[model samples]
Target: MKSFLYPNIHPPSFTWINAEKTQIEKVHEWIKPITNKSNPVECKTAEIIVLGVPLSRSSISVSGASEFPEAFRRSWRSFTTYNLEDDIDLSSMEILDAGDVPMHVTDIRKCHQNIIQASTALYNHFPASTICAIGGDHSITAMMVKGMHRAYPVKKIGILQFDTHFDLRDLSDNGPSNGTPMRNLIESGDVNGTDMYNIGLHGFFNSQDLKNYADEKGVHYFTLRQMRKAGVRETVHQCLEELSSKVDVIYLTVDMDVLDIAYAPGVPASTPGGMTTEELLEGVLEAGKHPSVMSMDIVCLDPLKDAHAQPTVKLGTHVFLTFLTGVMLRKV
Candidate 1:
């Protein structure tokens, strides 16, 4: 893996949102195993570790998502208990709240570099561990993939992006931003563009230019309409089978906007008539179960827009927990 320059970035302060004193008390009871005494716990040996990269930059989300990491942590306090069906105890696992990566909101380049630095450190430290990254925005996907590429240079990396938009805009003039993550990843040369696959793309919002670009790059894509026509199970099965043949390591990136606006109104960009929360959960869980999945990122959640905060926090927890269950089952 390539060495990063900013290894000395300060750790993030845990600022919980909407958490009452009693709620925090209950959360701390179970989270003790994950958090450190002086600092948050750093898992030395664990099959999986959840790292919070709450990087909120104005360039990424128009409403700002830097506050998501703290809000998510607070919401997790209520839902962190073990599940009997999965027969897995999260507290028993080598899970750690590595905290958020520091970012210079004024300098977009510096922020991207910081993400690369932090993700690269984690990848190198735990080569075998599955990384569950809590995102700042969809743009962070580019840096995370770059870090993974550095860690496993020989592995053929594939990106499975669950989003409504194509995110293939080549913004050469503006540089890389949240809307241009996929384009930047393809241009980076670390990942094979042909091996990339995007799911949940709906019509009307997507243009022919984006489709042409995807076709030109040999990127595999599936629309929500097509998935509805073929049924979710068959669609997901075909996607996995096709991607498995093209790449050795698969990284899944889920943009909350992929869900219908009614289901995920807290995202920066909400599209109507998209996948439902239940369908997304099922599809993502199935994808996570695949042996090729190495790491995953969930992004574009805005708590401010979420009335009662359930849409952003609860949905985020649901996705994370489902993925965790899938990973545990894969081991068995």
Candidate 2:
């Protein structure tokens, strides 16, 4: 793993604050950084393995999303491993932060290939762990899911995509951008469209042709209005129930643009009328507790575009923690 891994550490912005935590109760105690080379880590023994992939060169829009992982670490120090609302403590959980994936500067294709290799290696080596990835763009998710498929060919994998756009853009004229991941996955036979489900799809970001493609491919989706009308909890429960029965495992990929722009304007494609922070959290929580969920990712957010305090990054981090909160309940 060290051959492909880059060391991760607490950002200087909050190191002083984190120092206080390292002393006693560890106020900002979160994941254990796998920073040692001599002391090799066995990833499969951990309950959760978190990895960062900072490859945003493939986004269709101009982006600084590659900085998201470090920003997340900074925000991570502001919070704790305890969920006050649920009275759950994650400090004892064997979670390994294996650090960020080494990415190519100008080679998008190379980056994707490396991501696939990293994902396959992680999933293959850590088959017993829940692999949670932090992405540089939605494109990385395609590679992540594909990697999982490569690692475990016999397992029927399902996708739970929470986003506004269909992410099925035609790539005849374009390269492998974030918009084309799902299409590539579907066309390459890496995943079956019948096993995929999209939630929080709203706004007019997608086209009729894309809708036709989705319908023809048998992809399941729920519009923002549809989920709201049916109730977030009920709709998500329905999706999980249907997909879990059909597939051996589910992989959740959350595009931050699914969030309302007011809550997450950092994402290039985010818009109004998308899911609220609370709504998205509820859906993620549901996925976290499901026995079939093997992996998950949060993507499409650029920290550079966020507010002065970077609320969107912070909120995204919260979404990550909320997912883990639900995961803790599964133990009970």
Candidate 3:
């Protein structure tokens, strides 16, 4: 049992939406919480489990990304369980909040180990549940996948990442930064590049070396331009088709920087040229509709950089809602 896991033991706070005397039940009100236990969790009730990893020491750039998971939980108050686009009531769905994996800010290695241990323990206990995570930074993903592989050694996992960068930077010189997770996973033989599909890559954010490395590894990538040209739904379906068919399960990771800087100012590395909010939502919804998608993590959020309106934070929460709505559709 890892001593680093902290379940949401505190009492719930009043939602911002409710302060307005609204009759609608917001997402935070609908979400169910489960305290972390050292023993294997009983898997009879949950359909999805949400884990928080507050880590950022390994980011390639300076950021307050460690504040993201908490920020996301708070942001949950702003959304309703209803999805107008899908005509699905998320109340029909089930989400088990697994609280957070306490991060060791000064020790990236230790923090990663906590993520791996917590992920492996929880996943093994609830093997049938879909795992979802709100991250401190992108680095936690490599560790999470490592745990996934450990929990189910026989399963071949596919990755579907929505990001601006390839995140394939070699860790030889710098060791396990946010920019090196994908490469680290591939190098470790935990995830195959051929089973990975990276979407929303654009701008001058990436390098030729990284592109060459990705190509050499056989990573399938589709740029924002390609999404626009091919249509978001079409491209996503094609990617999901290939991934779901070839791998036993799919892991979806969304780097908030994949959105345009104008819309996602809270993301540490967001740039001018990126996917529109709608494009990203639509893209992830496609992934959620597929039964093979076993896990997802929304990362790179830096709440300190957010505007007073808190658009970025709220948008990130909306991404989860839309995806869950897709899951609801499939369940019905």
Candidate 4:
């Protein structure tokens, strides 16, 4: 196998807190950081590989989303990896935090290329490994999806996008912004538009033009109101069942703005009404455990916009753990 060139760009280093012995039994204790270069075999042997992509230059509006990975890592230190509901402790799993991708400040194209290299490297390193990527912004999803398609060319890839916006706008004039990733993916043929399923699309937050374009392109979508009417769980089950039948593998991309502004005020495009945090968690866990789901990402958490209480940061970290728990419990 060709080894991936690890980017030389500088990003935040993973910092392990020196918590008191009494508080050592948290999720921080479970997450093992891959700070140094490891043997190729060692990298390939991990059950789960977590990587951070810290580029936010194409924010479309708000900036500082690049700081999300570090903020989420910091918040994760305060939680426990053990799931009380599932009665499972994830500390035993072989999980590796592969650190953030080296970001380019001036060249957005270079930053996106680095993301593709990182994703391809991580995915190709292991035959059975599932990846969980922390985002700089939703635009990175275009590169991640492209990377995955490159890594597994034979399989048909399905995308499950959890967000408040369709993100299918044309960016021909502005370059590649976060609002244009899905459109780019469809146009590039990395993933078919019909294979893309979007949930929690909020009213007023998305324009009629985007909705019409999505429908015209055959992108499967459901609004927050539609989801509420059908019940979130049932709505997800219905979508997942139909989606799974059409594609060989599923890649889940979560945009934090999917949640109500009250729940995720830190997101760049957050609005007044949206899905509840619990609804997103349940849907993510359900999808993570499915046989067809191979990789996932949570995007658009701008730490600068977070509340003094840091509720959005806390929720983002918790969602990562929740998805991991579901993956850990998957049947062989």
Candidate 5:
């Protein structure tokens, strides 16, 4: 195994109390007690740090997704869940909102470096705790992967990308963008392309060349059609089995575009036949069952595009809760 690199970067300095200035303060209050200095006698403290990397115009129009972290925080205050039947308790989990990473709005490269720096800082303090990153765009996923590799230094890391698009676009005339996160990670050699698995791929947008490239790289491509044929339970089981054997750690990345446009209209990209929100929840729940999952990210939320902010924040909150539930369940 390669030795882990501990970067001296640090999370932006801000108090959680300042969240009260935004609509997400209510959500902060809800999870604050559990994440407060007083709770969690046995459970590992979350430190629930929130790092917002709102990088817009990254070779794609989904640039509006940069507002997701703040939007999610503001919207989570009103969000509620009664999925106790599924073994989830929002009250028991410790979640801290660490705030967003500071970045130069006009500079994509600088923004990317800022994301890596902030994420590396948080990883230093909470190497074993969950770090929930809100999206500026999908490009941030590459840096998150970088930070995880620097911290864990595993020989093999499995990347589970749930999205409507393959995000396999190579570096272009404008450089890397949200659509090229996976490709960037692979190109940078931070993650083995062969160990990657992309789920929820749908639509007619993909070409034969893209499919062949993914296959040639040994990236496991699981289409929605195949998953439907195998059934969610069996498909998820098989994915876990394969990933667990091939990698020491797993990173779960969710792009909201994977959900149907009707279910998630707030994303930069939308596909009509995408997975339903319930299906997404179930898939995440199942993925979380795998003990090897090391970190997770929920990206591509555009509050501006969402009507009344109904599903954008709601969906984001649910994903966050589902991720927490998955992490907790894995501990058992």
Candidate 6:
């Protein structure tokens, strides 16, 4: 019986996203729990606490994505707390930053367990709060989903994934990587296959076996071509309508590689043609509006591989903020 490790890493303070020093407060200025501190600032009032898991060892192909959490936090200033689309300001929103889970534990199994245990604690402590786990890779998705289920075992959990690949492959010789999270989740019965809704799956990035598995297990999915024909809004509407009827909760996960390579060249599994940033953002916003969506994550923004301007990180931050905007609207 190996207990997970917890390291002492001080969480970074939120830098105000608002640069103009407007009367409206910025998201960066929001207070968060200091890492490893027993007495974190009063976060019970927070509706959401964002946690980072910078473990990339499970990624089958690319690895440097462990850098996304810090990079995303650094890019927070580029966004505004004001939600232009929903016409809402989040200055009044109580947000807590719980800092990153230490990645020093070299054993991938221990790392995975650490994520589950930490996430479970966060969710249990803040039962009313949505835990947004920033990923080191898609593998973290499995851990977070499990943690959420552990916290609320009575409810049926659903998954809404926006990505180019199905990520349904079984474990390889190296064990569970980013490619296996969905498979692991379904197999573990944490989420019923039919309750999992995936959008924007496309290209040669996936294989027939994985696609077959998705269909065989009754996973609801819309291909990128289908989404394009039906429109992003319509596709998302369909996803929400179907999943909402079947499950008590929805967990939204977005892999940045879902965006076209032009938009998100920094991702570990980026492809040439995929959803536009606006489409992905729209999907996220729509997903957030659902009452059933309890937690969310955005993964695969590798700063180490980013372009000079850090376009992926910038867009990723926008999506993150915009999702919060949707959550604010939900409160209204």
Give the winner by TM-score: 4
For candidate 3, the per-residue lDDT at 221 reads: 99
* Candidate ordering by TM-score (highest first): 4, 2, 3, 6, 1, 5
How would you encode candidate 4's per-residue C-alpha lDDT over 1-332 as one tens digit per residue? 11233452233356565545543367777666664454667767788877888878988886788998888888876788778998887877777777788877799998988888877777777658888889889999999888888888888988998998899998785567899989989989888899999989876877888889998999999988888898877877787788899999889899998998988889888888888888999988887777778889989999999989788989998888888888887853
Query: Candidate 4 overall Cα lDDT vs. reference?
Result: 0.82
lDDT of 5: 0.71
Give the range where candidate 3 is weakest over 10 consecutive residues by summed lDDT. 8-17
Question: TM-score for every candidate vs. truth?
Answer: 0.87, 0.92, 0.91, 0.93, 0.85, 0.91
What would the TM-score be for candidate 3 when compared with the true structure? 0.91
Model 1, 159-238: lDDT tens digits are: 88889988888777447877788889888887767888888998587779878998998888888988888876677767
What's the lDDT for all of these models?
Answer: 0.74, 0.82, 0.82, 0.82, 0.71, 0.80
lDDT of 3 by residue, 1-332 (tens): 22223331221222223343344367777665553342334534678877777888888788788887777778777777777766777765666666678666487798888889888876876788888888788998999999999999999999999999999998897588899989999999999999999999998999999999999999999998988999999998999999988999999999999999988999889799898898999998988899898899999998889999888888988888877877777867
Instruction: Report the C-alpha lDDT of model 2 over 1-332, residue by residue, as the tens digit.
Output: 34224322121222223343533333246566654442445545788888788878899998888888878877776787778888988776777676777777788888888888888877877888999988789999889988899999999888999989899998785567899888888988988989889998887888999999999999999999999999988888888899999999999999999999998989877788889998999999888988888799999889999988899999889888888887888888
What are the per-residue Cα lDDT tens digits for candidate 5 across 1-332? 11021122323222334334333324446554222233333334673545556666673874577667667766655655335657555545566555566677588788788778777766766666667677778888998888777766755678888887778886864367887888888888988778788889988867676787788788887888988898766777788788889888888898988999899988888779989888888888887767777677888888888878467778887887776677667656
- Candidate 6, residue 220: the lDDT equals 88
TM-score winner, 3 or 5: 3
Question: lDDT: which is higher, 4 or 6?
Answer: 4
Off by over 4 Å in 4: 1-5, 8-12, 17-24
Candidate 2 achieves a global lDDT of 0.82
After superposition, which runs of candidate 6 have C-alpha atoms over 4 Å from their true positions?
Answer: 1-24, 35-41, 172-174
Better of 1 and 3 by lDDT: 3
